[model samples]
Target: MKPRILLVDDEENILKQLRWALEPDYEILIAQDEYEAKRIFEIMGPAVVTIDLSLTPGNSQDLSGLRLLEYFLTQAPSTRIIVITGSSDEASSLQAVRLGAFDYYSKPIRLDELKVMIKRAFHIHQLHQRIQQSYPGSAEGFHGMIGKSKSMQEIFRFIERIAASDVSVLIAGENGTGKKLVAHAIHNLSQRKDNPFAAVNCGASPEHSLESELFGHERGAFFGAYAQKRGKLELAHTGTLFLDEISKLTPALQVKMLRFLKNRKIERVGGTQTIDLDVRIIAATNHDLLENNVFDKDLYYRLKLVPLPPLRERKEDIIPLAHYFVKKLCRGRRSPPIMLSPEAEGALLMHPWAGNIRELENLISRAVVLSSHSVLKPSDLGFALNSIPTDVNLKFAKKAIEADFIKKALSKNNGIVSRAAKDLGISRVNLYELMDRYNIQIQEFKISRSSERQQMKTGEVL
Candidate 1:
């Protein structure tokens, strides 16, 4: 059965557009007013809901949409509610997010962005369900991560214990051991859940760009600085900032970061003003920064260390994580439920996963896409029972897959960013960010004006 989603909006045109776009992937139920929405909620019990904050047109006094949001939460707190508001209604949208709504979107609706948000909501809800089923009567560790081993349980307990405190945290883990997820869990469980949770990758970004990205810069900060921009550190004020791969930070950047950690103030690039910020620092590293002479000793001493066990060490959790990824990747697809064959399960267990959880997920994703049969065997996963590839660069592999998809989308859309983003089921802004990360320029995919004119003259659509 398709995952059910409820759409609550007074505008008929919006409802029609949403239904047309989302009907293929979801069982969409439309409600034009609060009474109808309530009735549908009681009967259908949708897993996801999109509600307009101003349900009654030209009636500002009637907060029917917000009331319905409250009512839905009261009835089923697990149901993910996405609030829709006017473009200028920031206060109401923020209020919705604060009131336990999963997320909010503003009008006029960008279908790509809204669709991405809806898909995320469904994924989160299903993931929560999977975790509860996997752990049985265990306490909820975190929303987006799955772990059932003894070591993971202890780690969860540790997170819960330290989440309430305002001290700096340093998470040490291998590449695919989910260091960032742990950071998110800590931030979500803390008092700063509602605040912005900003993240930057020290290894992925260039050292020259990483500094400006971390700290805001004045308009005349550097040669290419056209306007003043707030960096991740400043933007994460009163929230949490996650610095991944912190061991890769340069000596100069390390000194600057350490200064900000010591005093809750930062001076922007080429700016004299020191801005005070109440941001919590959560840094992750694949290597031991203290043992490595490259990292600053003062910074190392300031952070509370938390180590994450790699997947190979916690072998008991491998099958569970595999099953979780299989379900997550296969959900909402128009196909029969896929299961792992006995041979496949055995092969998975025997393989030494050097790339950790990420490798497993990537393998499962490939199988899901390529396998025709419902039962996936060892061969379906590109794994032989005897010899499994152990020297895979999982990070590069994942990036290659992402970059490939973006290139295909851009090609299909003739290099138009908005169209490509829609084709990829993501916001244009998100697509641009990915393009930037991969150093993909739209100009590379653009057709020449002469070629376009030639095609037009030939009676072909340009």
Candidate 2:
């Protein structure tokens, strides 16, 4: 079917002329008044609409056309509306655009120029539809996290499978990758969801207090202990205890934790009574547990590891996640749904998200709050325009492209050097050599498979 276009103008002659020009390329729907335009818009759901701002016949006193434009946009934001205004009415034309009109034409009606605008509007509409369809759970989110990348989808599946299990889970990722969110997801999906989910940041407090924080202290246990207090472990009984920055745990705390896991019991700081509790442990760290000797080897072995890759490794999810954050942050605000312009989207995709999901969420939230325009442009995002190179040197470009390809291959094949090498039509040895040259670690890709096995063993999935 030809794309639908709605033309709204007070003059019959102008509407007829536009219909004649657009009929061949589009299914033309003409509306001479506000009522007719709205009726057609509601019934047809046209992809593009052209409205004359001076809709009240000869008076031109009423701004019904602009009101109608706002209504159509609020009702169906995906539909692109182009405003038609006299050359002198620049202010109204600008206002129409600000009210979410796709574009505006100064009328002495250039049929060709109007046609080009309509075609572009239809193109943008189609692109928007495609983006909406491709991004799964973009609005609803998955386990309090927003991403539609293959790696994230895998993570969602793993979470579903392991959430009900009683085993200890160790989530490893960068500082802003939402490790705590993952811990929440696991608890929320588990049988112990109704129970309290206690979280403790091991790095947030002093070493002396860290032990008492994890394990309860009796009355008069310390100078500050006026009354008996339950620590995170005790409070999280019959629930999940999220231990953030577990890598920061002091040696004394680590020994206490290891003992608790081994014995399924904990002793209060000043009391000899051994307390038996059923608590699930979910630990998170931004450090590499195997490479870093900072974490206890025995404790690490006791927990099932779930590694979250950095955002740069999952470039495909950037735009969708940004849109998700925009919708999330803009909720309850007076403005309409904020949109990302093409340039803004490009900037989001091109920039290396060092802080990962947390960084992206913050950037988008700030943009939504600060930007006055309905559409969020690159300037609104506060990214330095020079951050992404405009002029690419051939040698650097070639190497960059090669590195991206290698990373993608490794990611797609689950970071197995042999599989990635075969997929890239190279030997495993050659792949290893290239990876070494590029400073790529094979271990980054291995987490998916290992997590999958852990999920399966825990009956997270069939």
Candidate 3:
């Protein structure tokens, strides 16, 4: 089907011109007033929208367009929006972009240039869709998980293979490695993409509230249950329910979960009727299911297809994942995507990534805020690079050279301390303590070559 574009303008001449320019290329939705625009918005839900800056009482002002922009963006965050403004409306145009408009066209609009702007808007929308659909699971996949490690790719493959199935999935990862995205991907790929993919963080919600949120409540289900309300499970019927920190489930809740897993049914709080569902279930945890032995064996078996390896082991995928997040999180914002300079990328590579992908994402976001140049610098990322070849001071030259020497020795040893120490003409014990002192991750000291080429072919990244 042809993508739809809702064209909102009070002037008949401008609407006619746009319709003439774009109707052949798109399905045009024309709205002459705010009321008409809203009506079209509710019904058509166009893929993109174009609104003029002047559509009020005098039909020649900026405020009307700004208000409409806010309403449209609020209504549909993913929809591409383009604003039209007069030559004098430079501040309004930038305001539009800040308000989340994709781009603004200065009027009297040039037809061919306007076409390019419209095309770019569509391009942004398509890229967003791709990111949402095929995000590889892991912290790296979220805001960029750390390490381009082989183990991470294996996890990616595992997620891809299982995303097509309706079987319950269990994701096991370290605390900060982003197990939730894996759960999300599975939900998105399953047969219920259109339905709500409701998620509840088991560890975050209190026991009482968790129960109420999961199964909902009747008017008198609990002390605060003033009115009957639908639970996450009910809202997620025919879709997917993602439970995070699954290991945190209390013993009583575990029994409830196991029953639902086996029976495909739930009873609302204080309600007697059993509700059968086709909702798919995905569970995630920071704890090792096999190690804790607290997870119900039956439920664990039902959920487990196996766990994804941690980010520290996935060295090969780190850079690509970082690039993916840099594009997603920074681009087209008040501060657009800042390029990672060679030093910045190297600094990122050198870190142990203790918090894994989540940590990296936070760093990148912070860097975007701090960076002065178009290219993000190491200092912008808040890391004191031992390998800093270019600090403002020449006084640190000796320290930099020593850091380089230590790094070279570690590399020659293939992460074997004894061998690296021998190569450096130092004691293995000394080297071990030195590496720790410098915060070097011996296991990930080197970058992975021959990157994983396969893009996630499974569920979308939403």
Candidate 4:
């Protein structure tokens, strides 16, 4: 059976035209006014709806259509609503979108364009359903990490499985990808849950200070050591110690850390007495420590790795995560309920999310603080139609490298797709995909080859 769609418009001709065009694809339900539309919507629960903004026939000011749109959304936030308005009524159309309509189409709606918009709405609705169905628990997310993708599900399961063990664990991911959160979750679920969880940023302080922070210094040990101090490892005692940015640890500190990991003992700076501690180690890094050769191999091998996926790779989680952030931020501010406009959601989906979950939370927080409207549009989240990359150097470098490799391979192969694919060790299909992704014109490469050949021939003739 075809998917159901509700069409609410006062004009009989418009309804008939849409039914004729869409009947083949969707189970068409037509409503001539708000009352009929609401009745059908309540009964049928269609996945998509197209409603005219002015539903009171001659009264152009009547906003029953907007009210109906709001009602449908309130009933089912996942419902895709496409608002239709007169070509001159742009203000009403914008207002309808701001009220959480999926999209807006103006008068003189060509059947083809309207059909395309309806198709996109259904697609987005299906995605929302898939995310909700796949996500197991409430919107609070898995141990504070919000993700609906299969990768995240696996990560959650992995955390649960390893939380009972006492082995050293390493959580690895790009910066702002919530490595520290995972570390905390591991500790919270472990047997040492009642004990204090101590956290230290290896990269946040100078080398001497970081060493002193991790392994306490006795009085008179250093210039600022006015009193005997307990370090993170010592303070944690029977609990977990989260070492963030562990790759930044200096070689001297790494040696001391490895020794402690092996023997579960530590010596304070300028102190002879050795301290026996039973702290579980949970280290996190944004870089590949082993691959970079900056971290100690013995220490790296001791910890079990838990690699977290970046936000861009988990598109299914974007909307849910955004909503979660909005709710959290609004509740903190004692603000009323705020909804993300479909336009804003689309913008978020399109973004590359260089800064991952942290970036997303910050954007939503900014929007909630600054925007007075109950609904957030793309502009409210600092995202334009053409969104820019967040200020993350690593993501930019990776993109640049990938594009350069493709261009070099194409140049070496004289614009031949097969040869370039072989050079890049990828399929021709993949090469073409990459070329399209980077907006690299094959015609430019092919034309350059032709021009070079022509130049050679002209020189020979001369």
Candidate 5:
């Protein structure tokens, strides 16, 4: 199929030149003014559009072209936009990027280089379009989640249900299950979708900061209280506030949170007024909240627990979830849907995902980038299970759990970091961070590859 192109310029010569150069690759449509350009856009819905910064009515000042770019971004975000600017207008060209223009080329067009950029942009456009078509939802609806398994379908149902109400939702899943993504989905689908969706890790922050962050502090409340600052609850008013790892909150904070849950009111650290909050609270826990005494039963009960079945128990959803994350992340790469060989699929089923869905996301992503072949084999998934010692505790340290999780995904991806990152829905940078955090060695991992591939192969995957 021939790709469609829309060319806009005030200068007659430039339009003719671009048409002559890019015509071999696309059916080019030329427009000399902003009004004509938009008309052509509405009719043609071109795959790629190159618009000059200066148009017929606003030749010297390029505000009209800027507005056109903004309109294009808002109306047809999948369309790749390349802005044409004068040689002297570097500042204005950069401003186009700020307005969400895909790429900018200075005037006095270099046809050869500009064509390459346009082609690359179109590829990315096509990829993102494919994602939208396949998912049938905005990025904010699904974001990084990739699942079609019955279990995942159930999770989607839960998200839809909770998003309709203001009741507190408690998401329960094993480590690395994308609970945070679920919380985000709930917020995005709710009545407060347009409002602030604030999040803070209950386990990560210091106790004092957690208190101040959840409940605002007045000036002179503590040593660091130089000025009055509203906490997360106050800021999240009329929005959704996500408290991740709720089971990890200190007992003291749990008591305070319980009060907030009941009263829907907060007292600043040094202030007397009890501020009311209209925020929806969503809490997540990797721990077995019902069994763990470390987690407050009163607060957990109040939060209204939503239990998430671990990946092991929901084996039917593995392939669907794998396809989802891979398709979503590979949107710009134009990468094909990754195929898992029957052996690979068996490996996915056999392994109990201790880290759950998060581990799966990292594995598939890594495999997509690192696999030379389109189909992923068992070896490609690094699924030779590592032996775990009985003494190694997964309960307390989040990093310890994360390390075990990555190791499993790496094993599934066959020690491929890029694939592992995708499988886990994390960036390659994050994979490296996990390696360091867990002190894992890739060499001991069964799937062998490049030098850095040897990095954390030895990490325990339990």
Candidate 6:
């Protein structure tokens, strides 16, 4: 069956024309009034809808369409509602958009233009539905680190293999790539899960204080040493110590770290007593220790290396990670799960993500809290349509649209590749080729439907 599109308009001719123009591509459900529209909307749950700003035949100031718009949005926030208004009523059309209408078309409807807009709306609706369906549990793959890309899956397997050992591990990644989270995962997966995991930033503290902060200090060790205190190394005895930004450590501190790794022993400042500790060291650095002159070769070589790719390097994980943040952050809110519109998802994908996961998380959190509508659009995510680069080649744009269309078709058919191919008017082999080319996972779409049905049974949205 074709995707449903509810058309709400008072004019008989207008309704007939839309039905005639859109019926070929959509299952058209016509509503002559606000009441009929609401009834049909609740019953059919159309993915895309069109409503006139003036629903009452004679009253130019009825505003009933606006009321219906709000009602439809409240009842089914995921629906893509396009408002139909006269050219003179641009203000009301804009107001409808503000009230959560997806897009607006003027009175003199150009069937061709409206058709394109409607297709785009359905595409967006499909994307949001896919996200709502697939994203239920946390996206965290291993020990609270979120990612499902091949790179991250490999990291998960690697962490599991090496976590039980007591080797000193070095994690290298750009800032905000979650090196610290990786360290924590290793520690939690290891036998030291029950022990305390201590963390210290090598570059955050002053040089004079960093040594004492790591190796502890006895009473009266310095002018400010009012009492004896155990440092991170001593405090993490029999557990894990996370040294963040290890490349920033000065030469003197690096030597101290090397010595500690060698014998697992430390000497307190201003005290002769040597402390023997049983602790595991997990050091992280944003800089490339091999290329930079900031790190000691001997110390770097002693730590087993784990490198993390930046967010842009793993584009496949962006959407899932975004949805994960949306669900996680909206748990405390009274409303249902906040959704990312197609444009928002595209913006997230196109972004360079210079800050990696941290940047994405912050954007989603802010969107969840600040977005007026339950459905988050590009503006809610602090991205404008103009922000997308316009210099792209025609081939890339075609590929993007093609992939989106295929995904929608698959989603509409509940991931039955054969049915989806039929719906798309293509052969199974051709569809499979497209899916493979775009790395589209049919099983994920299939899983999304099951998960959505389960969530619906429990009265959980997304």
- C-alpha root-mean-square deviation, candidate 4: 22.7
Overall local distance difference test of candidate 3: 0.72
Q: Listing every candidate in turn, what is its Cα RMSD in Å to the true structure after a full C-alpha superposition?
A: 22.5, 18.5, 10.6, 22.7, 17.7, 24.1
**Overall lDDT per candidate, in order of appearance:** 0.82, 0.81, 0.72, 0.82, 0.75, 0.82
lDDT of 2 by residue, 319-347 (tens): 77887788866763646888987777777
Model 3: residues with Cα > 4 Å off, grouped in runs:
1-77, 80-94, 102-149, 325-330, 334-338, 374-377, 385-462
lDDT of 2: 0.81
Better of 2 and 4 by TM-score: 2
Per-residue C-alpha lDDT of model 1 across residues 322-429, encoded as one tens digit per residue:
787788667625457899876676567666788888899999999999999889988899985457434333343345457867886786577999999998899999
Residues 57-129 of candidate 5 have per-residue lDDT tens digits of 3456548889999887665666789988888889889999877788899866678899899999889988976
**Per-residue lDDT of 124 in model 1:** 98
Clashing pairs in 6: none
List the candidate 5 regions with Cα displacement exceeding 4 Å. 1-144, 292-294, 335-338, 384-462
> TM-score for all predictions?
0.57, 0.59, 0.59, 0.55, 0.56, 0.56
How many clashes (backbone atoms < 3 Å, residues ≥3 apart in a chain or on different chains) does model 2 have?
1
Better of 1 and 3 by lDDT: 1
Candidate 4 colliding pairs: none
Local distance difference test, candidate 5: 0.75
Better of 3 and 4 by TM-score: 3
- Give, for candidate 3, the lowest lDDT window spanning 10 residues: 451-460
Position 421, candidate 4: lDDT: 96
